[model samples]
Target: MKKPKILVVIEYIGENGNSTAYYWSQIIKKLNINYHVVLISPENKESLKFSKLYNVDSRLVKVGEHNKNSLISRLLGQIKQTKAFIYEIKKEVNNCQLVFTGTNPIVTMVFLSFFKKIKKFKWLVLVHDIFPNNLVPAGFIKKGSLLYKILNYFSFLLYSSPDRLISIGRDMTLLLEEKIKKGNVVFIPNWASTDKNKPENKNKNEIILNLGWEDYIVFQFFGNMGRLQGLPNLMKAIKSVNNEKARFLFIGSGSEASYIKTIIKEINIECNYEKAFFYGYLDLNKNNMGLNACDVSFVSLAEKMYGLGVPSKAYFSMAVGKPLLYIGDENSELDILLSEYDIGWKCKPGYSDKLALLIDNITDEYICSSMNKNPRKLLIDNFSEDIILGRIEDVVISTI
Candidate 1:
């Protein structure tokens, strides 16, 4: 008997600093019980997800690397990529009944979506972030502009390409249901197994002891510090704390790092400001060491991101069972979660005093107790890798 075959399609084959690629890779590996994997991408770029299955592939195809300039240039690349993708995966396309595309980059998903239609294969689209919707008008897409109209219209239609949409959060699912086939939508939360993190009730490791015993608190910020994430206020709030001992640690970067640097300079404070420190962007996947270093994990979304995009970090933090100091605008998902769950506290976005006070108040015991609650039980029940991967398998098996 032949093993089931599945094609995992992503926008590219690159190892982005982002965690989605890693998650994509892991899901496919876990699905091996039902499918023999065939990985496809537009770029020859590195993806740890693709790397592991390279030898196991029924087929591994790189349709194109993409040229990032000019519409015509990019579209031309897409067309060429589409053609090569079809040409190279001709066998796997037929052998596999299901195709799944994207944790991000709708363009890549679009190509795979189009391919499934031609091959008459069933495909599912992973809704990672609600694009164009998440794009702020002033910074990303200006208001009353043709590009704005195009983005809004395009993103709406893009939601339709998937025969089914697999979503990572409620906010994203709600967005898809409004625009696409509601029957095709499913709430699939991003999840990490509990085995990945060691619970730290009274973590008195040598490392913790060597690094600790400080008068001030450490406000930790990890992941991409971008405009969409609203990190300026994070740093600003830290500055406002006005405590010689309280410090801020920012890890990771994006297009907005320069602006944050400017804020730090304008404030004329030295790096690490007494207790302020940055372990810098940890190659998080390299080892689990870095993520284990903290008592509390920070959750943030740009002031405007509320209701539009669910922070991916939310589920991950819960998985680790960390006390979250979720900072965002009023009525936001994080705000509601922290409030109702009692797993953590909330800080009003852009309000330094409130954030400062919250950090000052957190106790090690509080963080430990919250982690013990398994607040993500609802999230895990639906979105664990097992459930989501199984759903993808079913989509493929049904098409076949």
Candidate 2:
């Protein structure tokens, strides 16, 4: 018998070497069901390569450039692309057995709200980032404003229409339960690519040598350097640290990249020691090597961002057997996991003094080495691809 088809819709499919695309590609390849992928992205070499490697029927709806600096441009681009996407997928929508998508592109949510009402396919909504709720904390929108009320209602309608709402963290699941039906919400934490991200020696890694970090205890933050990461606090913490044996690396690009550079320049004038280096975005293929070069990984979130979104980079740090230095909410899902597993350290946002102290304390050779061992074991036991995907398979089968 032929396998049932699943339609997976996403904003960008491995475009410009996106890591989420790489991670999802692994999951899509392993899925037993036949699947078709629809990407709302500019037609590019990376997208074509992604489709070929995944060996799936893929279609791309051309969209304008994604400009992070211009909110109006971003929205207009999505609106234009979404219309094309809806038209392209109209014929395939009714033929598929299920539709899987995440809360991205804004357009995807808009599409789901309409598609769920007409199609008989089981709608699986992956809540990667909560909408208007997350925006209120980030100061993008006022809570009681007319725009907020409108967006909130739309978000509620979108989320409630799904057959199953898959959340990335326990805190997210609870929040979803408040908006969505309790029975529809499910918690499935993101997984790491353990097989792809093995531990590597810092001395032998080319990326480390290139950055002149061969002798230092590196604290690296690799991924989107956006407002929600609380990067200003991290930069301040690194500047305050007097330890010559330690170095900080910021890799990746976003709206905050220019701000990070400005901060680094100010630190350079006052601090004699070359403490921090900012390396803008690296491709997905080189991300593993970049991650392996670090002695410890840093993951941060703004205080107000707690429970709204979880940093997926935490899993990559663990997969590579590197301990984390997290600066975010003390009660967040990542904070609890780090404390429970004894794999990393956590400090509250904007507490640069406390973060500096934590960095200074972990300089001991024995302490750092011991903490590194726990992450790999933790990855295998809880966050491995096979383990998480097995649960996902169960969810998919149950939906059918």
Model 2 / residue 158 / CA error / Å: 1.5
Off by over 4 Å in 1: 12-17, 42-55, 61-86, 89-91, 113-117, 200-215, 243-245, 258-275, 285-287, 329-333, 363-400
Q: How many residue pairs collide in each prediction?
A: 5, 0
Lowest lDDT block of 10, candidate 1: 199-208
lDDT of 2 by residue, 1-400 (tens): 6677777777656623565665566656666344444433445677778777656677766666767557678788888877777876686787778777777777757876887777756888778778878887667889899999898888888788888988888778877887765578878888887878888887788878887878778888899988888988888887888777887888888989999989888787788656788888787777778788788899889877767888878898888888888888766788778768888888999799989988988766633564435798899899999898888877877776
Local accuracy by lDDT, each model: 0.60, 0.77
Model 1 lDDT per residue over 1-400, tens place: 8876677766544333356765666666666656677776544436544565445363445555555434457667767765656665665677675677764544465556556567777776667677666656116565467987787677666777667777765655666777664567776556655555444532453333555623334455667666667676677676666545454555566666666666656554554444445545566563244444456677776666654656666666566555677877766556756666667778777787777666665644443344355545644664465776676556555544
Assess the local accuracy of residue 351 in candidate 1 as a C-alpha lDDT between 0 and 100: 82
RMSD of each: 4.4, 2.3
Lowest lDDT 10-residue stretch of candidate 2: 32-41
In the predicted model 1, the residue pairs found to clash are 13-45, 15-46, 25-49, 189-383, 272-276
Question: How do all models score by TM-score?
Answer: 0.78, 0.92
